[model samples]
Target: MCASFIVAAHIEQNLSIRKTAAIFSVSKSSVQKLVKQQKIEGNLEPKPRGKPRYSHLNNSTASLREIVAAHPDATLLELCELFGQNTGNWVGRTAMCNALQKLGLNRQKNSEK
Candidate 1:
């Protein structure tokens, strides 16, 4: 998508790289890089786009799921604490929450009776 936007930016839309980057909330260098890549490689896939998987998380996903399944009401902080205890190193609350979300373990708000 970013590549399409960049390639079409000049003749089709007459939008500058800086303007396109600002509107897209991306770096101008990204737009320029993608434009160059499209011209050279004819492909637009983002390389190294997101966080690399943590080996700890991959190796212990089963244990983490077990802990959460045993305690569905646990808050993210609580999960992090438990994870740290199990792994001997702390997992960030954000990472824990993301993992739980991916695992279908979201904490929905409970309605009071």
Candidate 2:
């Protein structure tokens, strides 16, 4: 959306770099650089940046909840294998345990279990 807005401001709206940046609530030099790049490449696609998402939580939540509910006493490694087999996702043991912990299932100390 930011890329689209920047492209629209520069191409469709025919706005100057400074004016485009001001209108888009971004830095003037930012707009100037984008405009320069667009003019050079004739492209406006936004580059992908930032850390990549590891898990697809949207679809995994139901499976995770079911697994946790079915086996609250399951170990971290057990949960990881179960999730991987059932949902076709190989989650790290630590990550799976952390997720379970977030859902109120923490590993008990040696004496507690």
Candidate 3:
């Protein structure tokens, strides 16, 4: 945010965009972008960056642990299917694996199943 203001001040003082970029060690596009943001948003202050990530399996951790405890030999697909049936959320294998990892559990089979 401070950098944005400093760049803008230099440009307002008649510094060329290229020179401003060189002094700031930023790209000309970056300088232009900041100036444009200042005009459009009416401030050099930062904006929130990205969308918050939400997991469908967030509400099913306890049931997941119990299911894994019961079926230690389940594959990724089987676990996802079972979890969907239990929670009615119907997520994919990757989501199931990520949820298991978040819960600090193994998503792998104990033995051949």
TM-score against truth, every candidate: 0.49, 0.48, 0.54
CA lDDT of 19 in candidate 1?
A: 88
For TM-score, candidate 1 versus 3, the one ahead is: 3
Error of 1 at 50 (Å): 8.4
TM-score of 1: 0.49
Least well predicted 10-residue stretch by lDDT in candidate 3: 1-10
TM-score of 2: 0.48
Cα lDDT of model 1 by residue, 49-104, tens digit: 78877745656779998888888788889988988898787888888877777777
lDDT of predicted model 1: 0.79
In candidate 3, what are the lDDT values of residues 1-113, reduced to their tens digit? 36665565666788888888777777889888887877788777777899987777888788999889888888989888888788888888888888888889975544656
Report the Cα lDDT for residue 102, model 3.
Answer: 85
lDDT (CA) per prediction? 0.79, 0.76, 0.80
Which runs of model 2 end up more than 4 angstroms from their true locations?
1-32, 36-49, 109-113
Reference-based lDDT, residue 10, model 1: 49
Model 2 is weakest, by summed lDDT over 10 consecutive residues, at 104-113
Q: Which candidate do you rate higher for TM-score, 1 or 2?
A: 1
